[model samples]
Target: MEQKAAAKAKAPKRSQFSGMSKALVRRETISAYLFLLPSLFFFVGFVVVPMFICLIYSFFNMGLDSTSTTFAGLSNYVRMFQDPVFIRGFWNTVLIVVVSVPAVTAFSLWVSSAIYQMKPAVRSFFRCVFYLPVVTGSVAVTVVWKWMFNPYNGLLNQMFNTVGFDWLGNTKTAIWCIIMILFTTSIGQPIVLYVAALGNVDQSLVEAAQVDGATKLQVFWKIKWPQIMPTTLYILIITTINSFQCFALIQLLTSGGPSNSTSTIMYYIFYMVYRYNDFGYANAMGVVLAIIIAIFSAIQFKVTKTDN
Candidate 1:
């Protein structure tokens, strides 16, 4: 009886403290949210409100010149699924993201690793050369690339013809040329990020590995690679997101032409809204793209967590 009474007394104290703790938690949450009020207001006004409008607008037939919105529900989404251009655009974006992400990421990492071994001045010179393309506008780059890929007069075709091969005029060759152009133009920022990451890698670890008789390749693969994994993930995520929204390059370089082979989702969206007067379906595409990009960025953050 005594023991049971003691247990009963302890339970009420624990319960009382638990209740107080939960109240305190609620208070803290309210305070935190209060602190977040101003930023949240701006976020809601800009991002959240626009997102909500897009979501609602995506389900309505809001044509140009029509002041009234008619309910479309899943009609726009269903039509998008059946749309061949939309399908092609979706697939092309995926293709570019998959190919370009790894190519740019790996090449940047390799180049940065090489540059990491060089003198500061030499490294700066190379970094500046690589990054010069990044500051130059994408439209200008595409225009220059268009000229460079010209069937007769372009430097690329000239080189190919010099090597006694037909180039750039062929559908296959032109597509590859476009890919190389996009790849080269996008390589700069990734290279810079990789350079920063490489700079942070510990010299002590590299020396320790060498003292343990680790070869250059092994040291790089095991030590340097792991150290820069976080930076690589960031680069990959940003590149993937940016690749999806590629408009200027496609619009300028090929305009999804040579038979719409290079049409990306963003280009498709732009045309659907701006050219075709289909705001409903465009909103659907935008929302879906935004959701995908958010999910990818979240995955990147989780994967790169140092605690992991």
Candidate 2:
């Protein structure tokens, strides 16, 4: 009878504890959702709504005037292929992506591997040095680069003693100059991410591999590479997307000039919308560009997953 009474007393306490936990969880969940509300509101309003609007507009012949709009029904998309300027822009965009992505990834990984094991202060200093251009305004960076690439008074020409050589004017060198700038700005974020990823690698596995007579290369490939694959995948996708959206440099520096040699799909899209009032075509190009980015991201995802 005493044991039964003791059991009966404990059952209420257990039930009460469970009830308190449920209430606490419910309250915490409500707080979390409340915290998320602002971000969700902006994301839905700005990004999701705009995407849907652009997709809908792509199928119509749109312009600055609403009355001018009519059903285009894929004609704008069809016209993209037939347009020579767009073709050139497409290939140029492709070249930028092809060149920038691999170079940025390799260089960032190399720098991170070299610096991640340094003292905290030294590591942070190097991180700031690499990341300066990223935090600096794009306009300022472009202005400095523009002065450097100036034909007569620029540093490059003066240093080389090739006075009045238009680096930004020449068809062959213009795109490359843009590429170099893109490379500098692009590596900062990747390097930071890679440093964090590399620092988080399993030190025990790495030490064991080294103890087994594995060389640095062997240990990296066998142990560290798989661990940092996710970071690598992220870097590849972001770099690829940035390369595809190569617009600011082109606009501020070249404006797709020198016989349209430096023209990219992004610049072309801008030209179409503002210059020609071709909203439909611009939206179609945007849709296509989005699709291309998606495909490339998917490929990277698949390849990285397989490697891991």
Candidate 3:
């Protein structure tokens, strides 16, 4: 009877401890949710809400002024496909991405690899120099580029002694000029990321490759490159996205001028919203741009995963 009584007492204590553990877990879960509440609120309020609003607005013929909405039912999307300006803008955007993504990735890789082994101070100086354009606001950088590319009394014209050809005015050269500026701003972060990735590569593997009489190129390609593939993929996606959204420089410098040669979807969207007050059409373009970006990003992710 005494042994039975002792066993019953121990069982109750075990149940009490388990109950306490569950209660503690519940409390911790609630605390974690409370900590996340603020950020969740802002994100849902600002980003999620605005995105849904844009999506809904795309389906209607909405104007800037209130109460002018009518059900568009994909008319805006239909018009977008039919619009010649949008077509030109899309092509221009494609060209920018095609030209810039590879250049930025390759150049940043070269810069990072070259400087990763240098003295800390020297490496930092080079990084700062490359990153300066990014810290300098886009508007400021665009303005400076504008002055440099000016036809008369501009540094570039004076240096080349070609006064008649306007760099930003000529359709053939305006896109190139925009690409150059885009290149400067786009490279900074990628270089930083590459440098960090290179730093984290396994030194022992690199040393072993070198000791085996492997060439520097062989060592890098065989050992280092695979490790940094993630960084490269990240840079590719971001650079592609940024190139597609190449608006500020276009707006500040060319204003998509010289027969819309420098026009991009972003610039076209801004033009529609403010100049034409075609809110529904603008939103439709936005939805399309978002979809395109998502598709490109998905492709990149799939390629990276397959490579890995």
Candidate 4:
């Protein structure tokens, strides 16, 4: 009888301990959510709400004057297809994305592979060198590039003995110059990411592969590549988006000039909003650009998932 009474008394204490743990977990969860609330509020208020507003505005004929708003219902979208400047801008945007993404991915991977095996201090030095451009303000970088590409007495022209040649003014060379600048600015983050990813790769697997007499390329393809697929996908998508939104360079350098040869969809969207006060059309273009980015990201995700 005494043993049974003792067992009953201990069972109540066990239940009380369990209940206390449950309450503690609930309290911690609430505290965590409370900490997240501020970020959640801003994300919803700025990003999510603005996105929906843009989508809604895209279907209307909105202007600077709010009283002029009217339902346009696909007219803005239809106009985009018919606009020649938009068409040119679309092609230019595509060219940037196509050229920049692969180049950045390949170059970053190569550079990372070379440097990741180096001593820690050496690796850090290279990482800082590459990442400097990324951390530098876009406007400052553009100014330096602008000075370099200046037609008269520019460093590039001085070096080439073509001091009077206007690089940004020539229709043939303008887009290419922009592409080159974009390439330089875009490679930094990818290199840093790739270095980290490569460093994190399974050393054991690499050693085993080497023991089996695998070539360096074989080990990379069979071991390292698969592990870094996620990082590569992220780099691809971000580079694509950045390339698509190649605006400040064009704005500061060419302003979509020299017969619109350097025009991109993003620049065109800004031009529409500021020059024509065509909010509806600009929002429509924004929507289309968003869709294109999403599609590209999806394709990258699918490909990377398959490879993984």
Query: Per-residue error at 117 for model 3, in Å?
Result: 0.2
Q: What are the per-residue Cα lDDT tens digits for candidate 1 across 1-308?
A: 34776899898777754646777978888999999999999999999999899999999987686786799988988987898988888887888877887898889888888896799999989988888777787877888877776766677768767533334445456456666767877888888898888888998999999999999999988898888877888898888887778788778777776577778789888888778798888999888888877887887667666433
**Model number with the top TM-score:** 3
lDDT agreement with native, every candidate:
0.80, 0.92, 0.92, 0.92
Cα RMSDs of all predictions? 8.5, 8.8, 9.3, 9.0
List the candidates' TM-scores in order: 0.80, 0.89, 0.92, 0.90
- Model 3 local distance difference test score: 0.92
**Ranked candidates, highest lDDT first:** 2, 3, 4, 1
Task: Compare candidates 1 and 3 on TM-score and give the better one.
Answer: 3
Per residue, candidate 3 scores C-alpha lDDT tens digits across 160-221 of 98986699989999999999999999999999999999999999999999999999999999
Clashes of 3: 0
Question: How far off is residue 57 in model 4, in Å?
Answer: 0.3
* Range of the 10 consecutive residues with the lowest summed lDDT in candidate 3: 14-23
lDDT of 2 by residue, 1-308 (tens): 34776999999877754646777978988998999999999999999999998899999998899998999998999999999999999998999999999999999999999999999999999999999988896778988999999998899999999999999999999999999998888999999999999999999999999999999999999999988988999999999999999888899999998899999999999999989898889999999999999999999989887674
Model 1, global lDDT: 0.80
lDDT for model 2 comes to 0.92
Error of 3 at 232 (Å): 0.8
User: Candidate 2 at 57: error in angstroms?
Assistant: 0.4
